[model samples]
Target chain A: AQSVTQPDIHITVSEGASLELRCNYSYGATPYLFWYVQSPGQGLQLLLKYFSGDTLVQGIKGFEAEFKRSQSSFNLRKPSVHWSDAAEYFCAVVGAGGTSYGKLTFGQGTILTVHP
Target chain B: EPEVTQTPSHQVTQMGQEVILRCVPISNHLYFYWYRQILGQKVEFLVSFYNNEISEKSEIFDDQFSVERPDGSNFTLKIRSTKLEDSAMYFCATNRQFADTQYFGPGTRLTVL
Candidate 1:
């Protein structure tokens, strides 16, 4: 079985500051990873996803995540945080083969608070 | 841009009552899914539907839970007998193809009183 762990429960950063949210996963093989964001009372929006190729994958809203196989991590990062970026973020992983389609194991999540 | 849409933004139902949450996925999408998030928990996948049938489901989707695409556009999740634990924000998502990018709709908040 695959699982995901997000070490940070909450993080606060000032506007224009750099931000990083850590995520680690346990999977037997190369996995498909994704990052999603959800504002209060809103549906989750996909921030980025990593299937293969480059270790660093860029996504919408100027966000990016690096897939580190050695560490089993896919941490999301943004160079400059905007106030609007404040939201709860989740890291998820899906297994590689059979029975993996649409099966996503999500991390507990990390709430981000951006301040001016 | 085309997007998934869910109905009844908020639903309040008594425990043991039946409730249905509806969604209309993007017209061309071939895969549809239902997920739920408890008030303070991570989102969990409940079930996935493809080719007009269920392709996969989680343990959370038991006999009490069922999904249907009664029409060409509308997909629904029906809870036979709701429990307090079932109270959560239910989301509907669709992907152009299996294992591809998925787009989510505004969730329907179900409150089982």
Candidate 2:
């Protein structure tokens, strides 16, 4: 079984301030990690994904996340957040192998609120 | 990014009524999936379809729920009897291959009253 935990329930940051959202996962095999964002009334958009290679992966809207295998984490980071960046973020992991690979287990989610 | 579209951006149905949600991929895709998010919960996987049959499904995907690629293009999920708990944002997603990044539709907000 695979699961993701997002420690922060909600985070508020002023415009131009740095932001980090924590995400940890439990998986026995190589973790196929992903970050998704959902704005009000919008669908979940893929922010970034990590299958292998670089530990740090960049995503759309200037967001990035680092896959730390040692810590079993893939935390999202942004040097500066814009007011429009306010949205709900989710971290997900796909379990390993077989026909069972398509299901993506998601975190509880973290709501990011950007202030002026 | 892969593209997918879902119909009935919002659907309102009376409890016990049947509701069908549709998903259409821009191009041909072998894998199609359905997921849902309750008001304040994580996005949960419902089921996945491939090669005209279900490849995988979660526990939440019960007997009342069904999926099919009836026309070889439009993939759909049909809930036999709507319950209050079935009210949520149901999303349709598709990917090119196994372990591939899935592209999600804007979703259909199904409200069962």
Candidate 3:
């Protein structure tokens, strides 16, 4: 079955520290990966997406992710964490084969807490 | 930038009552979708609509759940009978085309009593 895994349920980082959130996916074919952020009581906002080419993709709010085909991982990274950056992050994948239809399979989200 | 919009930021409905959640997707988008996120859970896909018909739907979308475009620019999801388990945040999203980026609305919080 096509699925996404977010290993961490919660992460804590101090302001000005670097942060990394892990994400892995299982699919038969090349996958379309996306990272979304959801603030409290707000809708999910697209942070970045990787469709094809350029394994390293840059996203808004100084976020970036690298897609590793060999490991089937698309992990998000940030060089510096800010108090406002604390939120829930989700990793999702779109199956590209016959069963795929633009529907996203999301993993259990990772919650980030930044202390000032 | 155009963003998807949903009506009634919050709705409280009684059990067995029918409720319709309305949305206006981004104009010029060809694909529309509805998803729900139960509190403290991952967002789950409900259904996708294109060309005035459903392109795909998850198992959770059963006989009780229906989606309609009704007219231009408006998409709606109707649940025939509400249940306590039905309480969740419903989000409406749209994309210009398949395999493209999707923009989501603020979401409607449905509370079934």
Q: Which candidate is the best by lDDT?
A: 3
Model 2 agreement with the true structure over A48-93: per-residue lDDT tens digits: 9999999999999999999999999999999999999999999999
Model 1: runs farther than 4 Å from truth? none
* Per-residue C-alpha lDDT of model 3 across residues B41-84, encoded as one tens digit per residue: 99999999999999999999999999999888799999999999
Stretches off by above 4 angstroms in model 2 are: none
Q: What TM-score would each prediction reach against the true structure? A: 0.97, 0.97, 0.98
Q: Chain A TM-score for each candidate, in the given order? A: 0.97, 0.96, 0.98
Interface RMSD of each: 1.3, 1.1, 1.0
TM-score winner: 3
Clashing pairs in 2: none
Docking quality tier of candidate 3? medium
lDDT of 2 at B19: 98
Worst 10 residues of 3 chain B by lDDT: B95-104
Sequence-dependent TM-score of model 1: 0.97
**DockQ, in order, for the candidates?**
0.71, 0.81, 0.76
What does each candidate score in C-alpha RMSD? Answer: 1.0, 1.1, 0.8
lDDT of 1 by residue, A1-116 (tens): 88999999999999999999999999888799999999999998999999999999999999999999999999999999999999999999878676777677889999999989
